[model samples]
Target: MTVTDQLSKVIDKTSRLIDLCAALQEENDLLKLENDSLKLSLESREIKKTELEEKLRVMTLARSLEGIQPTELGLSEKTLDIKQKITEFVREIDKCIVLLKK
Candidate 1:
């Protein structure tokens, strides 16, 4: 090929490569933004889950305490059972948070 023709071809190739690189960089930026959004969404979900778990724990304790016979039986048994149930629920909630973190 003539020197001029070879140089023209090289310029064309170089131009195409530059365009491709620019396009790839744009795509990479978009992907990074999408990933960041997903991470935020996941963190929000984890916080909501934790809140719900805590509410459930509170509801459970409230329900258990509501039906107890405070007149005849001493407060010791009811308090003990509530403490145990609270401990168990807290442990379970901890496990759930650990799993979510993973």
Candidate 2:
């Protein structure tokens, strides 16, 4: 082949490669954006899950307290029991907070 023709072919190939590279770079950028969005969504869901779990724990504790009958245990005894239970729940919540911080 003539040197001029070979040079022309090389130029054409180089142009095509540059175009392909640009396209690939655009696709990579889009994928990176999608990955970041997904990570944010996952983090939001996990936070919601933790909140729901904490609520569930509180509800469970409330339900257990519901079984207490003030008539059966005198008023003062019932009050003391409730205070103790609340103190225990607070401790548990504090522990959970510490763990979450870690």
- Each prediction's whole-model lDDT (CA): 0.83, 0.83
User: What digit string (tens of lDDT, one per residue) describes model 2 on residues 1-102?
Assistant: 999999999999999999999999999999999999999999999999998798667655754786865555565645655775798899999999999999
- Candidate 1 lDDT over 1-102, as tens digits, reads 999999999999999999999999999999999999999999999999998798667656755676764445465645756866887899999999999999
Candidate 2 has its poorest 10 consecutive residues by lDDT at 69-78
Model 2 alpha-carbon miss at residue 89, Å: 15
CA deviation > 4 Å runs, candidate 1: 68-102
Model 2 regions lying over 4 Å from their true place: 68-102
- Quote the positional error of residue 39 for candidate 1 in Å: 0.8
RMSD per prediction, one decimal?
A: 11.0, 9.3
| Worst ten in a row by lDDT for model 1 | 69-78
Angstrom error at residue 45, model 2:
0.4
